[model samples]
Target chain A: MTINSVPSSKVRVRIGHLYGDLLNLYADRGNILVLTRRCEWRNIAVEVVSIGVGDRIGSGEFDILFMGGGQDGDQQFLEDDLFRVKADGLRGAVHDGVPVLAVCGSYQLLGHYYDPGTGPRLAGLGIFDMHTVHPGLSVRRCIGDVVVDWIGAPVGGPSSVVGFENHGGRTYIGSGARAFGRVVSGNGNNGEDGTEGVVQANAIGTYLHGSLLPKNPHLADHLIGMALARQTGSAKLEPLDDHLEWQAHQTILDRRASHVAPVGGRVKGSGGSAR
Target chain B: MRSRRLRTGFAVAMGQIAGWVSRAVGRGGGTALPGLVVDYLDPSALAHLARQLPGGVVMVTGTNGKTTTSHLIRAMLEAAGWAPIHNASGSNLSRGVLATLLRHASFTGALRVPENAIGVFETDEAAVPRVLRDTRARVLVVTNLFRDQLDRYGEVNAIAQQWRDAISALPGSHDLRLVLNADDPTVSALDGGSATTIRFGIGDPDVGRDAPDHASDANFCPVCGGRMRYIRVTYGHLGDFVCDNGHARPTPAIVATDIQADGWEGTAFTLKTPRGERRVSLPVPGLYNVYNALAGVASSEALGCDLEPIASAIGTFRGAFGRFERFTIDGRRLVMVLAKNPVGMNEALRTVVGRGGSGHHVLVALNDFDADGRDVSWIWDADFEILVGQVSCLTISGHRADDLAVRLKYAGVIGSIPSSGTVTVLGGLADALDGAVSGAPVGGTVVAMVTYTAMLELRSLLVRRGHARAYWDDAGVNSPEVTAR
Candidate 1:
């Protein structure tokens, strides 16, 4: 669909990709690209503003805020900027119910604190009532194909979401926050509880960083709907053809199933091995 | 010593038998079986066999271009009257290297082909330390390091630390000559002070990118916490850079000046060495390959090879298999480029689009198999968005075809063209190859950009279809059939 086809009266979804360049370690830019393209395919205008380190982001300037994972060094470079420069703006946006999706490193930073096991614990923005700990160097990272049964999903959203997750931190969801989903396969959160990700109001914090959206079109559309609803006061998203997307989603599920041996109840490829 | 030599002979004989058995079973080339047998029989088999070479061994290791650079060095060594034993099958692991050495050595652990033959083996970055600990290589060439296979190798810094440790531990009397990439900050900083280090880099300012790429790593000065200022960034973080703390790019002993890179026809550069300057033409394209050629040239120069013959050999050198290797299938030209990580994939995409222009048929096969690095997340780091609206027909194939198709669609590549191009996703490599070949216009080029294992699968399919020769049988990219295409 052409950009001009959308009526001027229709509200456009504005996305502020926080630390788009630096914190984009898992190809997390694909999330933003998918969100924009899905919106555009539905004849909805989408504007993406990259909010980098030391860049000032205005309150309520965007309908949605996206932050992806980053390397340890890169996260260290942005820790001060997150707390000093963009904390207030981000807090205000979240207070205004602007949908926020933070994955892995950004998810850890959205919590109360993140202990990287080497340096002093990094203070997070405290947007979510959760904290993450990197359980020493001896501990292996939680990585592989992750399938989660999404709880409290938006209307018309899928019951499950599939994505690849690679993270070392073990997040513990505390009071004032709810689990976003239940782990169907693979490690979620601390690998102890079945919980995966944090859900507090409209903000999402998860370690699922296969960009976490391209394979899960339903989730992408739901986030877009939430952001558009916050701005336009009503969410009426027209359904676009998602054949290829569902095909991708199912392929991951099939891959996960094939990796699990039914008889012994043992996980073959579910662990954090690189295959 | 006699007993140990007898044990080595037994190990070598077992390895040869195992290699023969594997090949007889039609399991393709016995690249690693023999090495496994030898390692099992005697852990020190490789080191023992390597000591038999009078000319010693040369090790090439880096994140990229290791295979091509090692092949180029082998070509130059052959031209200079040295029959070099090399692992030319794109196998850089320890097992592969051992197998290559065992293939050329007799049961007595002596050079079978030529008494004066040397060894040139491309080693994996993680395998470098183990290889170094086992053998005293005469020359070590490090192409460059980038963020690659995070799941397999933790990070670039970790690998760099490993290299530093390995380099420092080498015996001083061994006189290991290090050929380093002067442009790569991580590589250039690896002057361990114990070895004679020679640096090679691109000196042409015109070849630099307008700015550093979005995914550029190593931008921060390793010496200081301050940021690095780049005068020019050729691709990613490789270029001239200096830090506020007085840390700067090293002056390369071997440099390429006035580089003229034609994506298809190949790259031509004025090679400036410590001996003299000469014009060198590389059959393979990309600035990365230019760096590879410089690494080869510097390593050859350190070996006391005549610069004239080395330059002449490089001028006629084609690339390794699946490294921009071309073939004609069903009257359709197909150039296969192997891209396993972001930087390599970006370069391959640039080479394809730059040469083929708009409306080109492009096949991208992404596999997450073991050899290809199961983490497909790096594909997102590559700038595939550049192909949006550029190609007429794009086919995504492999075990992870759906993932790549989703990525391409999100990049707006599927529907970006005015007359929206066809974007097909096939599950099988053979099917994808057939689709791309049949759909491509006659006489037009179809660039197949594949991952490590995907390239093998595609090449095997082509061989079965009588389009391309088996990788082992094919001489090199400069083979008569390949060059004629």
Candidate 2:
């Protein structure tokens, strides 16, 4: 990969951060930082517009969409606004091939519904053919460093991505759906299957939330290229040195390979059982 | 009662034996082992031991500044001529409390202490309810609550609810006195019942930041789930706030005004209470320490101490171990500051950057050990960008040194290009310390910001090098020579 100093034309990219204030858990803003800085380094202008409750998403308003996880009750607080107000806009955007990246809780909300194994089932946007089920309060959360091989990627793109995962909902994709990757280590989506995330059109849904982008620059650029291809006329992106990023990514992979699972593993108990 | 005393005596003996064996084998400080053994032999050992104190227990709990605030309160109590038993080593679990009590107890399960002996303990956020149930502490001082160790303690709101339930469930005759931070909305609302609440806040508007911090864990109102409006924000969500649902900040009874924070020298502020006003000069840096000082004054006053001596004690207090400690190795000054979570790390960076001169040498060590939360994602949430133009040398260490280096790169402190000798990543703590200290001039200072376990390891390394004494052996603030920087 060569770093191009000059491009044929000036390109400006717009990003829509859904519920940026409410749904940002585990320092999810690092994804935004990675995307903006990578583009800036390539001399591409980027604008991030945070879309909160009762906010409207116009057509072609964004080239890429991102949503992150939140606290357990925070999802409940924003559920009505997400489903009633922004579901159709999100569905329309995904249909238009706008590259979307949704993390843990937001990924669960993008599915058909999330049954928390309690009183009510939270309705999702139905963007993907999947649904999540929390086994019960007795089951331990899938919290640990996760490594996944990027199975469905463009040729010569990122081979694998590494991040940290902390989620309780076990998401199962439908038979017709395709997976984003295969989990090489750590529990992903569920502990039973080797599947990690789901892929729908140009959208990606995963539970990896070490912000999921600073360490995996290749995956970030892959999303940027897709968004550029759909929104702009050209998809050409200049590559920069990712030495530190790759080192951070390989550090987790090396640690995972060298020892037993870092911290989180499958066990029984409630949320406060760590005490 | 006779049988119960005999059972307690047996548990105490067994716990002491275990602790002795643990120390003989060079395991740990044997902080939590004795408590675990006692809990197994006699489940109610904590309550039985805690009840023996003539002057009851005083607890300090919050997400941040628990250790420092408890240390300040203990100093204030000692200044008023009372010997207080404290968990000074910073082992703050329920078991750690039991261990402290066991260390103060006789082999026959009897507490041996001075006639004016009291108890002061800093407890973990999740273990508050358990500690309360055991000690029945008469005075509880809450500094502030921030989102910390989500992997271990779950969520901030869940912990708040647990604290409220615990407070409300106390016996009617317990007469609990609640000392809270009025600037923190979540902590201010913890006093819902009939307990006498002494609220403390920063009244100086000059210290407020122009823009809110990145970590706003308490932006939502604690009373109702509505978005809160901050009239003034001191730091990270600590400010005067109001919700549209009629919930507003209470008028703090104890307030700090006319603040002046000198980077490492210390922070001075006017401590105002109903009794009178006194100017307190704290030997600690940052606005968060101002809050810690006010909490110490409010808590000790609740324990029947005069405001004059309390202010003097806070004025001369050095600091808790690893919160901010100084050492001299070959004439190079090493300042160790503990940065556990995002908010704390932000304040630590702000203090370092606010120091007078440029070319600041900083060694940041981040670990993912059990003590330091396994998920190191919170580093991204901290504002290391403040070091962009200030840091002349940056060294990253600990188990997650690569992650910290990457974070500093994205924060613009480290360039995107290859190594330029400005940023170095060394995984070994001792090597990183040596590199950072030697990279600076002999007369210059090197600031070391580290996580919980990393600070412990670094302090141990310093002790081994004969730079400082062991933390558990540290005498109180009465001896000015020990803490003289």
Best by TM-score: 2
Worst 10 residues of 2 chain A by lDDT: A266-275
Q: Which runs of model 1 end up more than 4 angstroms from their true locations?
A: A1-12, A115-123, A261-275, B1-3, B108-115, B171-174, B192-195, B244-246, B417-421, B475-485
**Candidate 2 Cα misplacement greater than 4 A, ranges:** A1-9, A232-234, A263-275, B193-195, B416-421, B475-485
Q: List DockQ, one per candidate, in order.
A: 0.33, 0.50
* Model 1 lDDT per residue over B1-485, tens place: 88877887898899989888877775757778888888888888878877777788899999999989999998888888787778787667788888888877678876565655788889988888878767788888999998777666755666787788888887878678889999988888887443478899999988877566666667567666456788888887899999878899988899999998776779999999988999988999888999999999999988988889889988899788899988998888999999999999888888877775588899999988767776788877788988976888888998889888878877768877556567788988888888888988789889899999999989888888888777766533112111110
- The residue-by-residue lDDT of candidate 1 on A70-179, one tens digit each, is 65565676788898999999888788888899988788888998877777887888999998888875566776778899997765557899877767678998988999
Docking class of 1: acceptable
lDDT scores for all predictions? Answer: 0.81, 0.84
Q: Where is model 1 chain B poorest over a 10-residue stretch in terms of lDDT?
A: B476-485
Counted clashes in each candidate structure: 0, 0
Instruction: Give the top-scoring candidate (DockQ).
Output: 2
